[model samples]
Target: MPYYCDLGPGQKVYLDNPGPTTLITLASGSAGQQQQSSTQIHTGPWTEVPQIARVGSGALLRCVTAQGTYTWQIQGMQIGAAPTNAWVADQATPMQATEVGLSSMASMQPMAPMEPMAPMRMGDMQMSMNPMTMRMGNMTLGLDAPAASTQQFCTQCGAAIAWGDRFCGSCGHQLHQP
Candidate 1:
């Protein structure tokens, strides 16, 4: 399905697709200068803009499936504004049908503007104890939790150390437990 999110001033859209491939496009301004990226959806989340990128008002995120049928979800967060709007679009017809020039393919039709639903506060979202499950609108994304840290940095010489080390490997400084 194709999805759209209005990222108001200082706002950004976050997408997490734990499986399948997706194409993300960003359009801004009246001229519709666009930037696009194709990403393989692994177990980690990805964003349309860099975490540090400055997002202005009216930024739009357009996402479409690259292949296969898959469940997808996305959420928007404003830098200093609260989360309020959630939009969901109907499932997009598979690329195969559209590419073949099937006369019956609905994907060729222009998408209607999505009506804004009731606002969802950030606090109203549910988070499970297991990090994998995330709910965005009506879709649930299962993501692999990032691995826990098993390494530490040595204070004396700034060398890398395994979690249980008792001495600094580079400078021989005694390691103290905090």
Candidate 2:
């Protein structure tokens, strides 16, 4: 997908699964607060303008970026680490039926759009021990992070596995699979 921007206030951007899920709005703030900034989501070649409003870092915002990646920018996080840009360089590599859990024979279709105005909950503040501050566009709902286990690829058999597996079913390699 080509790059684009989210130019509207309150507008949301959704990304394909396996990519970032949200983008929050941000604007000028007092001391220690960030300066007024615009949030944009670029998808393929279209740049969307968002509705206008003052928003903070911690608020959950959602939008897909110009790189064909989805992102979730929480109000409190830095723009560089915005989930959308996290793997911006990591474009979708077609995975084998076994690699992506998708069969080659199956028809590939985009998923249905999620319900608009869906209620979203961030991480558990108590367990995460994070702060509880809200900002405009405070909630971004469509982002999905891959499980930790999905990040690993078996060195011996070239298969992906949970962090530690004792054995590789594909190549019969030994692993401590987490």
Candidate 3:
């Protein structure tokens, strides 16, 4: 899924630590608004750092990050708050630090409730709903793939299922009969 940033009126935007290219798909200011073309040689970051964007009104600025992507929103109208510059290069929150592997799940929503697993025997292993993985008490196990790689997985919970089985014993998801 793509990330979205909703900015209020007069709230400017900026790129903190960007990747190779932060493509601004939607700026939401003018119908004739065109993305400026540029080619610069930089030695520090991947793409570019400290990219500023003006937000006259409310808008959803959509951009893609390749390596280190951190889009920061600052109060442009307020002077005492911070710099008037749209984008700041340093950092904001600890979550924005791309070094900790948080950029991928920064805008993630809550996961759906998983169905309780029923007692089913699969090679003497207590299989759970997670795909190719099982949780026994607190320890988790990662199942190895077959040499032929003919393992069938449940569509709902990603648990390994028998090829001849109709319903997923882990999540009770119905499988199409072949």
Candidate 4:
């Protein structure tokens, strides 16, 4: 069963119910926003009560039924307002701290901060400078071009091709221009 405590300056409340209970409060303010006193609850009862069902925006309060789960958010408080029924029962990826140097993080629409990665060695890393040639190890790649004399322009991607190079180093286009 769950009960409400008069939240004094630093009072606390805990909820451990066999079935779910709803948390209703006196009208502290308007809808979608309310202010109240501060209270803390430490959930106890289930080893992993991994399901959450939201009755209302302000009604569904996660009664702290265990230690270390500080999830009983106060109503009208937008600090940690999680989506309704989004408890940890679904076995989804936990939101980890964002990293710093990940290439995939750069392409995110709203980029999140990345976690710092250890420095990578050249032998353990494989990256692509362009799209055609994937770099394997520490080596310079050369392409076939004109006979080391005639100026050649890349037919594709509009890049200049060096003499004796078979491919455009910049755009990876065929450099053997006539």
- What digit string (tens of lDDT, one per residue) describes model 1 on residues 59-177? 32333343322333332321222122321133222111112221212123555566654433465465443345667678777766554554678999888887678999889999986
Clashing pairs in 1: 1-92
| Tens digits of lDDT, candidate 2, 91-171 | 322211113322111223466565544333345321111122333344423324446535877679788766556777688
How close is every model to the real structure, measured as TM-score? 0.22, 0.20, 0.19, 0.20
* Pairs that collide, model 3: 14-87, 19-47, 131-158
Give the CA lDDT, 0 to 100, for residue 110 in model 3: 58
Number of backbone-clashing residue pairs for each candidate, in the order shown: 1, 41, 3, 17
Of the pair 1 and 3, which is ahead by TM-score? 1
What's the lDDT of the predicted structure labeled candidate 1? 0.39
Worst 10 residues of 1 by lDDT: 95-104
Best by TM-score: 1
Per-residue CA lDDT of model 4 for 62-174, tens digit only, reads 43433433343334433244554445434322222222322222123466566554433467454433222334566634433335445567778766666678888888876
Show where candidate 3 strays beyond 4 Å. 1-14, 19-73, 76-133, 138-178
Q: Over the full model, what C-alpha lDDT does candidate 2 score relative to the true structure?
A: 0.36
Candidate 4 TM-score, true structure as reference: 0.20
Better of 1 and 4 by TM-score: 1
